[model samples]
Target chain A: MIIRMAFTEFKLYLREPASVAATLGLPLLIVVSFGLLINPGTDTSSLVTYFPGMAIAFSLAILSLNLLPTILANYREKGILRRLSTTPVPPASLLLAQVAVSFAVALAMTLIVVVVGHFVIGFTVPAQLGGFLLAFVLGTLSLFTVGLVIAAIAPSGRAATGIGMLVFFLNMFAGGVFTPRETLPDFLNRIGDFLPLGATLTAMRDAWSGSFPQPLHLLVMATITVVFGLAAAGLFRWE
Target chain B: MAIIEVTNLHKRYRDHVAVHDVSLTVQRGEIFGILGPNGAGKTTTVECVEGLRAPDGGTVRVLGKDPRADRTHLRTKIGVQLQESQLPDRLRVGEALQLYSTFYPDPADWRRLLSDWGLEAKRDTPFGKLSGGQKQRLFIALALIGNPEIAVLDELTTGLDPQARRDTWQLVEEIRERGVTVLLVTHFMAEAERLCDRIAVIDAGRVVAVDTPSGLVSRVDAEQTVRFRPSAPLAEHLLTDLPEVSSVRRVGGQLVVSGTGNLLHAVTSVLARHQVVAADLRVEQADLDDAFVALTGRKLEESK
Candidate 1:
């Protein structure tokens, strides 16, 4: 039943062209557009790590910060969750289905970016495969949990979208998506290291450059995941 | 047998009471109505029965189980169509039905429900694109998809046109024909009169009366009025002398006679004896609307 619910949710997600464009099309567009300009072969600088990191970060950010909150809050606002509670199946199944769908989308986008970047853009796969996978999993969980918190508190769909956009931009700036962390000031980089998106990008970059991620970055992501996951579960309202 | 029994149910919010001292019972295989104007606690009462809200006081039992305590088990037996609830805009009709059918252990076939509710052509249509009548039909279809023994529909036709409302009423009747007990909540007098076997008239968070449509009207007053334009001038004493006639008056070439207990028969007999032709005759009796006014001291629409 949960699998069926998730499958239906995925189908509904596909029907929304705007969501598909943002989550899937936008990230691929960013990778291709930036890859053409920066030739990873000749640019031996740390700049090669910037493009793929930004693409993956953007995809995860859109899925977690924007889509997740907006859709879940909309379900509450429209009484879909209330309607589901009347059925024999619990409404939490819908919530789990939503999370599963979001996770699947994030995973699919990550793979697409990695493969397309490596083969088409002349970029290298992360040499430290274990570190890369760890960073990716922790980052996705942390960011998605933050989105769940937003969904739990937001009163309406429009408000959720607004709050999500604000958070997304803040994460983008702090995570070094707008400008490479290498170019940022030392003080700004210190702050960025603690943010979910920033920690993810820095860790992914380190793995891509044949080094394991810093333990501090991994710890920060894990802490955020636990704290925000608990908050979301505690505050969520079925109505 | 009584499938649902709500006794002395009391529920209140922080600042105000939504339902106060309400009680009613719904028998199996009958359409029981909870009729009231807006803010009359009609929805609150039904919500308690559905186990959507926990009553602050009183006991509610459905199919011999406490609604709140046995919610998971009761959910399979009670299908609900909540007021102001909606589906995702992009969810197709067929997909919505198919998805909900999986929620129950024994569900009605989605394909047959599609045809039963006249939604086969709209199976692929998204919820946002359907018309209001079609959307209501879809909601009813979803409610029955679980094959529940009791179906609760709240404000089923509040915003529908007259023709659409009538069509939906027919569909509700068909539901009863399937041996499913129905609990209908509405503020429309005609709707309750036409569909409900018995109605509990709720007012100001309390039940004012509970009886069949005709029974409620009789409770108000059995006054009947017969109006007609006489073909020839008739003597006023002719109707005044009859015991059934309470009063008689003439207004603009028409005789207005108000009385009780077979007043129409008494008046017609008198007219026939006097050889006075009564043209354009009309009879008016107390209806549910009048009963509502008498019971609550306010018209249903006025309270709205």
Candidate 2:
């Protein structure tokens, strides 16, 4: 029943063109933009080479920070959630449906980025294919879990969107989107590496370098997923 | 047997009491109307029974199960349409019906429901694109989609034109004819009088009167208000001399003769005897509106 509800929610989410564009189209557009600006052999290279890294990062961010919150907030604002409380549908089903929708979006984002990066940007994905896939999936879970927290706690739909933007920008900057964390100050590097975004970024960077994470990074990412997921579940309100 | 039993339901919001010691029983296969003015706690009482809101002090049993305690079972058997309910703006009418239908095990045929509610043309249209009457029709369609044993509708015809309102009223009758118990919450006196088998008039969070519509109306201290416009404003004694005239009051160049049956005939007889000509002579029958006003000491529109 829960899975059926989740599938129903995903179908509804996919019907919205704006949700589709934001989750699936925006990341591909970013990759195309990078493809235009970058020359692979140049010393002053563009961020096109970082497409695969940004793929996992962007997918996680969009699912957790962008898509899930808006959907949940809209449900709350329109009294859909309130009505559901009177029905047989479990409250957890709503949260699970949200995660399922984002996960589906992540799959689409990953495929787009991989195809675009390989052909247009002339970038080679990690040589350790198995290791990279494992790291990418774990990183997606971490980011998606963070979005669950936002969806649970946001007071309104507008507030959820605002907070999603704020969290996305902050995490993107500090999680080594522009520059690698190694070149930063030692304290900042230490803090960034432990953060959920920072940890996912490290996993993605390692995957891009054709090496698996040293187990501790994956552990930290897993811990972030569990902690935020629990917090979101505990604080969630059907009304 | 009663399909729904609400006993002394007391709901308070902050310092104000919303439903105060209100109790009513609705039997199966009957249309029971809950009529009240705005701010009269009609919605609160119904929502409590539907398990949407918990009553501070009361017991609500739908199908012999406590509403708040046995919510899942209660929900399966009961259907509800809230007063200010809203669906997603981009949700299509058919989609809303389908989504709600999924919650119930045995739902009505979607095509038949759309045609019954006159929403077939707007099935593919988004909810926000619908006109007010169309939206209301869609709501009614969604409410009946679930093949519920008991359905509660709050302000069913509010915001609808006269024609649309009559259509909805007829739909309510059709629903009852299918053996589904209905609890209609409304403020319109004529609607209650026309559609309800019995009515419970609420005021100030209390059940003021509960009976058949005409029973309550006849019980109130109301007399027929006989109104007539005379060509010449003279001798108030003309109407006052009538045998059945209770009181004569001049309201804006019109003589209002308040009395019981034969008051009109007596007034006309008196006027004819004196050869007085009256224009636009009219007799206003005492109805639920007058009873409501007389019982509450305030008009329905003025209560809130």
Candidate 3:
């Protein structure tokens, strides 16, 4: 039942052209546009990780912070969840379906970025495969949990979009998506290390450079996932 | 047999009471109505019966199971169309019905429901693109997709045009013909009169009356008036003398006679005896609207 619901949700998500463009197209555009200029194949600098990290961060932020919250809150605002409660199937199944759809979209985009970056853009694949997988899983979980919390508290669809945009921009600026941490002041980088997006980008970059992620970055993402996941579950309203 | 029984149901939100006390039983294979103006707690009452809400006090049983306690089980038996609930804008009509059909153990065929509800042509049309009447038909279709024994439809035609409203009413009758008990909620007097087998008139969070359409009108004072232009001058005492006629007066060239119990028949008979031709005759009888006013001391539309 949940699989059927998730498939339906995925179909609905595809109908929204603007959402598809923002989540999928925008990230690929970032990677290709920057990859052409940086010519990361010949360059030996740490700057090779910069473009791919920014693309991943942007895609994850849009999917988890922007799209996930808006869709869930809109379901609540429009009474779709309320209608589902009257059926034999519980409304929580719809929530799970939504999460499944978002995760599927995120996973698809991640693979596209990695494959295209390695083959087309001439960047090396992450050598520390275990570290890369761990960082990616923890980062996705934490970011999606934050989005769930936003959906739980937002009163309406428009409100969810507003709150999500605010959080997305804040994360982008503070988490080193806008500028590399190498260029930022020491205090900002210190603060960025604790943010979910920041911890994710740093850990992912380390794994791409053939090193295990710092324990501090992994701990920060894990803590956010647990705390925000519990908060969202507790606060969600079906109607 | 009663398919649904809600007894002394009480529900409140914060300091304001939404449903103070509501009690009604819906017999199987009948179209029962909960008619009331806006904010009269009509939706709140049906919500309890639908198992969407847990009443603050009292018991609600549907198919012999407590609504709140046995919600998961009762949900398969009772289908609901909420007042303001909506589907996703991009969800296609066929997909919505097909997806909902999976929720039930014994589901109605989605393809048949598509044709049955006149939505076959709109199979691929997104919900946002459908017209109001089309949207209402889709909602009704979704409500019955589970093959529930009881279908609870709330405010099914509040925003429809007269023609569309009548069309929807016919569809509701079709539902009853299939042996599914219907619980209809609306504020439209004509809708209740035409569609409901029994109606419970709710006012100010309480049920003012519950009876058949004609029974509600008869519960009123049963006063009727007959108006006509007298071809020949007739004595006012002629109408006043009849037991059924309580008062007689003149409006321009017409004489108006008001009374109770066969007042129109008594007035016309008296006119025939006097050999006076009654020109432009019109009889006004109390209807559901009038009964609503008499019971609640306020007009239905005015309460809105």
TM-scores for chain A over all candidates: 0.98, 0.85, 0.98
Q: State the lDDT of candidate 3 residue by residue for A1-239, as single tens digits.
A: 78889999999999999989988898899988899998999998887888887898899999999999999999999999999999999999998999889888988888888899889988778878899889999999999999999999999999999999999988888899999988989998898998899999999999988899999999999999999999999999988
Clashing pairs in 3: none
Over the stretch B164-247, how does candidate 2's per-residue lDDT look in tens digits?
899788888988988889999999988999999999999989998889998988887667787778876668876776678889
Each prediction's total of clashing residue pairs, residues at least 3 apart in sequence or on different chains, is 0, 1, 0
- Per-residue error (Å), model 2, residue B117: 2.0
The complex in candidate 2 yields a DockQ of: 0.53
Alpha-carbon deviation at A68 in model 1, angstroms: 0.5
> What is candidate 1's lDDT per residue for B265-297, written digit by digit as tens?
999999999898899999999999999999999
The sequence of per-residue lDDT tens digits that candidate 1 reaches over residues A204-231 is 9899888999999999999999999999
Identify the superior model by DockQ, candidate 1 or candidate 2. Answer: 1
Q: Write the per-residue lDDT of candidate 3 for residues B1-304, one digit (tens) a residue.
A: 9889989989999999999888899999999999999999999999989888889998998999998899888888888899988999999999999999999999999999999999999999999999889999999999999898999999999889999999999999999998899999999999999999999999988999999999999998867899999999999998999999889889999998999888888888888998999999999998999999999999999999
Global Cα RMSD, each model: 1.1, 3.4, 1.0
In terms of lDDT, model 2 sits at 0.79
Candidate 1: segments with Cα more than 4 A from true spot: none
Summarize candidate 2's per-residue lDDT along A26-88 as a digit string, tens digits. Answer: 777866776566644342332433555765576577667887887787788777777666566
Q: Rank by DockQ, highest first.
A: 3, 1, 2
- Report the Cα lDDT for candidate 1: 0.93
TM-scores, all models, native as reference: 0.98, 0.88, 0.99
Interface RMSD of each: 0.7, 2.1, 0.7
